[model samples]
Target: MCLRGSLHGPSRCGRNEGRDLSLDQPLLRIERLTKRFGGVLALNDVSFSVRKGDVVGLIGPNGSGKTTLFHCITGFLEPDPPSHVEVMGESIKGKGPDGIALMGIVRTFQELRVFRRLSVIENLLMSAQQYQEDKIVPRFLNTGVIRAHEARAKERARELLELLNLSSSAGKTAGSLSFGQRKLLSLASALMPDPQLILLDEPVAAVNPVLIDKIKEFILDMKCAGKTFLLIEHNMGVVLDICDRIVVLDHGERIAEGAPQVIRTDPRVIDAYFGT
Candidate 1:
């Protein structure tokens, strides 16, 4: 009844495997990804590709391995052997989170990851600093190079604050902001690194309706600027509106995939979300 594996078989997911990856390569490629927590199979040999500049939504019922797949792809959790994640055709199977970030992939959590104590501007600056300067030595030496780096980071942070409409709250403490504002801040922080592909986990969860529209608009704008995104969102309206394609999973296996309209009518997808 769970449809542990449906018509979308394990091997079929990675059908593009043998193609020439050099031409029109995907920004992110997941191959036979599997994850287990003790005896529980959280993800079962999942595979998919996110093309450059496309907004792809990952959706399913609760416990359908949506976030688990994100964790494995972003390096927060490692997959079992034979699972592979590729960025620009290079395997990142063993890379840690930081390493993956340095490779131009950044992510946000379902729960906001804002620094509560830091001011809005400071939060963005800290995120910018991670990628803009030498972390350890620069802090201690206080050389001119570090000073210039911090200045550049501050400038970039200001630009992001403006772009994200957080300029008004630049001096406010992150913890003092409303929940919706914190969500925007978390997304802005991830953008600080100017990553190539952003993996967002439940970005619109718990957000109010008005803020949801704003978030959707912002994502569309970013995509127009050529940022590729892989997002996990439960709001079917948002997913169908913003995503060019969608992947649906059930019981740790992918049950359906295609354009939003096709997926909307796919019986397999309907069964996965609504149950038999």
Candidate 2:
């Protein structure tokens, strides 16, 4: 399942025993997190723990600051970085977003950030961000490096295409896909890194019903495979269906958290989602 783990690396252990956290380690832990944009407090001392294989939902009213929190986690924003973030018990507060990704954390955007000019497969190939720079040097030297990179890239791309059910259009240019399809493509590309944890920003927003179901299924499949996710989504139907736990935010602060059934009936959640 982990391609890079199988390559040119010495392997010898009965198992990579982490924290004994039921399945895998506690892949992510957030503590006392805060964010500020000018005088606006986007997130206020929020805290949560997401273990390996847990699919937790982050929900809040529009402008309640869900996306702002994601930006802080992913290094797109640097507001009080050192005040939060821990991966496998190690602090990730000072690291840049690239550093975070390399530490086996990956995420998709609320607005898909795909390379439009690239073909579908090529776009995925570019998802291997860290490796691309290494391959570039080989291409400049007129060596087997570029050829090898292409072979591996194609192999991974094919797998992702099939996984996302986009195999039929693998060779098509990415810019031509419908908005829903583009969203799915961005998600598949994020999976190319085989991250231990992924933070999805509205993975099902603005998609057709059929595609939404497909995306929901994919999220469940990933959860069963021991992958962790912290999702930010607005669709309560989809959120209640897939999330193991729900965290509600209001005006940039955590208001409620629990199982879907409990959360759905929560007065705070109801008040936040609807009105008093």
Top-TM-score structure, candidate number: 1
Query: Model 1 over residues 64-175: C-alpha lDDT tens digits?
Result: 8988888888788989977988999888877888888888999998878888999999998888766542477756677786777677767767766776678899999999
Q: Note the clash tally of each candidate.
A: 0, 0
Residue 267, model 2: lDDT of 95
lDDT values, one for every candidate: 0.81, 0.79
After best superposition, candidate 1 residue 253: deviation in angstroms?
0.6
Q: TM-scores, in order shown?
A: 0.87, 0.85
Cα RMSD (Å) per model? 9.4, 5.5
For model 2, what is the error of residue 159's alpha carbon versus the real structure, in angstroms, after optimal superposition?
1.7
